[model samples]
Target: MNFEYSDRSKALQEKLTAFMQEHIYPLERAYDDFVHANEWQVFPELERLKQLAKDAGLWNLFLPEEYGEFSEGLTNLEYAPLAAIMGKVYWASQVFNCSAPDTGNMEVLAKYGTPEQQDKWLKPLMNGEIRSGFMMTEPEVASSDATNIATSIVRDGDEYVINGRKWWTTGAMNPNTKVFIVMGKTDPNAARHVQQSMIIVPADAEGLKILRPLRVFGTHESPEGHAEIELDNVRVPASNLLVGEGAGFKIAQGRLGPGRIHHCMRLIGAAERALEMMCKRVTQRSTFGKDLSQYSSIRQEIAKSRCEIEQARLLTLAAADKIDRFGIKEAKDLIAMIKIVVPQMACTVVDRAIQIHGGLGVCQDTPLAMFWIYGRSIRIADGPDEVHMYQLGRNTIKSFN
Candidate 1:
């Protein structure tokens, strides 16, 4: 497939890069400090930065052009490099309203929600007036197979009752997260994939409780912390059910395909930044009368990181291009390949950068530590690496047969 980015994509890449350098890079350290010191509260400057992003026309870059008015008129292929630029800083995506859970949630709403449902939630979300959560994983289940999701959504006249516990519900802890797209069983006896359904539940609904903020590598990941939430008999209007009772799995697959592309590209950007840092650090330091850059070992690490980053980036771009030209089903293998490859590559590249940074690596002094954490954590997020590999291996064997 031709992977050359269009002139439009190249123009966006240049504009986004300049925006990041001018505004995001200067405030990176302050943003980190504020989030750490404040805990669930947003860094005060984020709203202003977001307005700047909107004014600069970089907002909602993740939504695909197929969504018409809701989208920025960019294809998945066109959005990939822009996402990579935003990925260099963990919080930068939020500035452009391109962060996940939200991005996935928005896609689901745009694709599946009824007109009224979209009016109520999607508009606020797209306008950056509200945030959202995707509640699917559970503490007791091996959620890699989503059919194992045991949350129950039972119908009752005018409303549906929801009872379940969800952990790693990203964005639930944010004060601005006003809604959740929750997945649960609506018909236990239905066919395997048809048993589950997704419904919208207001974050403030009665009987819903925020159990606690779950930490990743001991950091709160504040402002949008991953949360453990208990939905005890939570109820919402029956109108909130998306598509139909058996459509959860279908909706989820559609939502995740593009989201995975966004995540992988961002990971590549993080890896590129780490490698850049590693190269810079080596040149500025010395050991035993020899520069760190002069050592073959250091040079080898740099070379390996560069090669791995390029490989992952190319693979992710190929996946994006496929998703643009073909449906998600046709691009499934490539999607699974990136899901299996990118995070691991990012983890390895960031680890080498951390090693080069020495003590400063593990500490908050450099973004290297957070980059490593993001790359490593993502191996388990979305779908875990093992699940993708298992599916890909099966697909490969079937192709041969």
Candidate 2:
């Protein structure tokens, strides 16, 4: 019930807010230009910013110590605001090594990897020496129900031979993405959720082909682009298996609790920025000798957006608090609720901004179009809205009974 951010979180927020202003916002154009020139390579300036964030004690703020001794020891509730701040700038998370795929992959390794696996992959990922991707969603299946993942990782002597096609494997296209955390069926006949396992495959392993970068509404999120890759007879040592056979579903479920929170928090940030853009644009432009903000309908739209953002932010905060206090399984309903809610909220907010900006909103001149695309993508990503809604409805009905 206490919604107040702790002093630690408050302090970090001020620091992160300042960091974003000084380093991130100022370089949005430079980062975009660098990536345009490099074509999907990591922005070199990000390395300089990464060092800056590290020096300011803003590194790895996403990993809570519940997994291991490696994190900054902040709880999910504690990290939510910082995530929201990072969310304001799309690329801000990586500078602090708090970005997706890597954060989730790092969590899995910290929680489940063997000591040797930790020393090999975990160390470098934590240090931000290399990047990684999670290969779970398949092009051939309804990945929303992760049980439908059809990849195969069969045992072959001391190594596991992985074969299948995975798409929307975010971060795979990055040159620094040296490893992948892949999920595939090891025992097809096992129980529904227990049939799969997670294994680590090196990016350079034989038979693994990263085909091409996929686009979100014709815009590729370059550098950390989503990739469709084929894993044919890809092999990795047995030691790379996370937890053990039949543990993929368990790991995936655990991965999502925090991941969903991060997504929802970032969505809030995106919506906030879009709303700001909309309000600013509306007031600055006018028709018939009246400011757009003075128009009753435009004011209503702005008010509606503000209300929606606050509602979604509160729900996201509740979900994060639930995960931190009650464990993810107990907080499933809340998590699912926000998963279904935040992206929709962001989409609506950004769409409003786009409408207000008219031609400029949809153009590359503003971040609205890109933010809107990201919002729409998440509606289908991380378990689609329909899936989450289905679960939430069932849970609600069961609760009333």
Candidate 3:
């Protein structure tokens, strides 16, 4: 029941907060401007910021201790607050090499890849020399039930031929995305979950085409845009298959457990920032001859937001602690709880913040609009709220009986 962070975690939180204040916050406007104007190009100052973060020993903080050499030795519980800090700024995680798709992909390679596969892909990803994507959700299927994915990976002599169309491939549009961990059906007749397998395909492999960039709320989410891709007869060596046939489901569960924690914690941070902005804004402006902060409705909204943020933060930490002490399998219910709760909480909180800010909230002048988009988008990402609710309800009923 102890939810207090360890001294190590508290120390890292301070350091990460200071780093954000000193570097990240100052460049927020400039970063947004460059990414919007350049489309698919890295921000000009990104590499320099990355170098500074690395020099500060703030890189790869997402990898837990079980990852061995690749990890920063922090458990999931320890990493939660640091993730919250990075979440305050949308792109802040990448500067420290702790961003997604990459984080999940690295864990896959570290845990399941053959030595050769690790040397080829994992190494580059860990060093931040390249980026990657996870291709699992399909445009034609009810992707929430990953078992519904219809991508086909057929064996062809010394290689595997992949054929499918995937959308919401988060990092696919990034120029530096050098590889993808693709999920496809290798044995359609195998048991429900075992039909699928995960394989690595190079970004430039033949028959791999970038169909288009998908937008969230009309924004391209520049640099690392979500993409719809066509993989037609894309071939890669047999060695690229992770672990073995019938392992994609297992790998995906492992990847998503921690990934959800990261997402929820970041949403908590975004909501916190929104509340701060809302509070600051209400005091500085007056409507109808009185400060907006003095209005009963505004005060109530602010209070509700604070209460919601704290609840979500605590729930996410509980999930993180459960994972650190037990494992993803044992932590499943808590994971589902946080996943079902945090994003919705964030959406409500951020929406209130937007309402309080009035016109500026919908515009790019403040990050509230973007924060709201992220919160709303996450409600469907990773396995939508309804899916988690279904599973959690089933688990709860079974436990009570």
Candidate 4:
């Protein structure tokens, strides 16, 4: 199959790449300085970054054709490379309003929310005036199997009352996070897959509490931290229900296909950055009376990393191509395959980069430590590697059967 970037994609890629160099990279040092201070004070430069990306026509590139009202529209295949480019810097996606779980939440609103819901939530999100979080995981249940999500969305006259504790509610720490796409059981007795539903709850809704930001490795990722929360009878209008009751699973399936592809693509970018760092580092550093790059073992590691990164990129792009050509259901195998492969590949590449950097790699002097941890975290995020592998294996056997 043809893997060449289309003319449109090529032009956008050039523009986006230049924007990254001119606008985003300059803030890299400032970002590190803030992190070392132990609090992510709202970045004053953030609004400027957003404006620059928007003016350059690189905004909302993740909005697929199905969400045209929220975007002019680019298919998953066309957007994959741009996303990979953004993935090079951990915070670059926000500059273009393409970060998740906002992207995933916006897709749900565009595809499932009522007209009023879209006007209120989706519009602001698309316009970059607000941010959002997804509350699906629970501390008490195995959230990897979504059916175990125990938050209750009980109907009460003109509203739905939501009750449960949720952790990993991403973006909740951001003061601008104005809404949440919450998943909970609406009909516990319905067929297993259809028992749950999604509701859009205001961040300040009554009975909703942000318990704390959940740290990754040890850092709280301030300003846009992952949060643990309690929704004790939190209520929103019944109209906030997305698509009818018992449709959360269906919506999640549609949402996660795009999300997984984005994550894999970004992981590819992160791996690329790590490889770059490793190569540059080895050539400049000398050990045992010779250059590190001259060592056969270092050469082998570099070669191995290059091969794996290229392979992962192609696999990710292939998955994006499949999702665009076939529907998400038909592309599930490729989606699961890359979801499992990309992060592991990234983690290994970053780990080698870390080793190559010596003590500096494990410290704040470079981004290798953060990249290594993020790639490691991705193995457990979305769905764990084992979960996706199980699905892929079952699908393989079923196809043969």
Q: Per-residue CA lDDT of candidate 4, range 1-401, in tens?
A: 57888899999989999999998888876876675575646677888899988899999999787665676578888899998899888878999999998999988898888899999999999999999999999999999999999999999999999999999988998888999999999999999999999999999999999998889998877778899999998979999999999999999999999898888888888889989999999989998999999999999999999999999989888888888888899889999999889999999999999999999889977877777777888899898999999999999999999
Alpha carbon lDDT at 141, candidate 3: 98
Cα shift from native, residue 113, model 4 (Å): 1.4
In candidate 4, which residue pairs get closer than 3 Å at backbone N, Cα or C atoms, i.e. clash?
Answer: none
lDDT per residue as tens, model 1, 256-352:
9999999999999999999999989999999999989999999999999999999998999899988889889999999999999999999999999
Which is the leading candidate under lDDT? 1
Writing each residue's lDDT as its tens digit, candidate 2 over 112-162 gives: 889999999999999999999999999899888888999999998898999
Misplaced by over 4 Å in model 2 are none
| Residues forming the 10-long window of minimal summed lDDT in candidate 4 | 33-42
Please give the TM-score that candidate 3 achieves against the real structure.
0.99
CA lDDT of each prediction against the hidden true structure: 0.94, 0.90, 0.93, 0.90
Candidate 1: worst-modelled 10 consecutive residues by lDDT: 364-373
Q: What is the total number of backbone clashes in candidate 3?
A: 0
Compute the lDDT of residue 392 as modeled in candidate 1: 99
Q: Which stretches of candidate 3 lie over 4 Å from their true place?
A: none
TM-score of each: 0.99, 0.98, 0.99, 0.98
Model 3: per-residue Cα lDDT at residue 28: 95
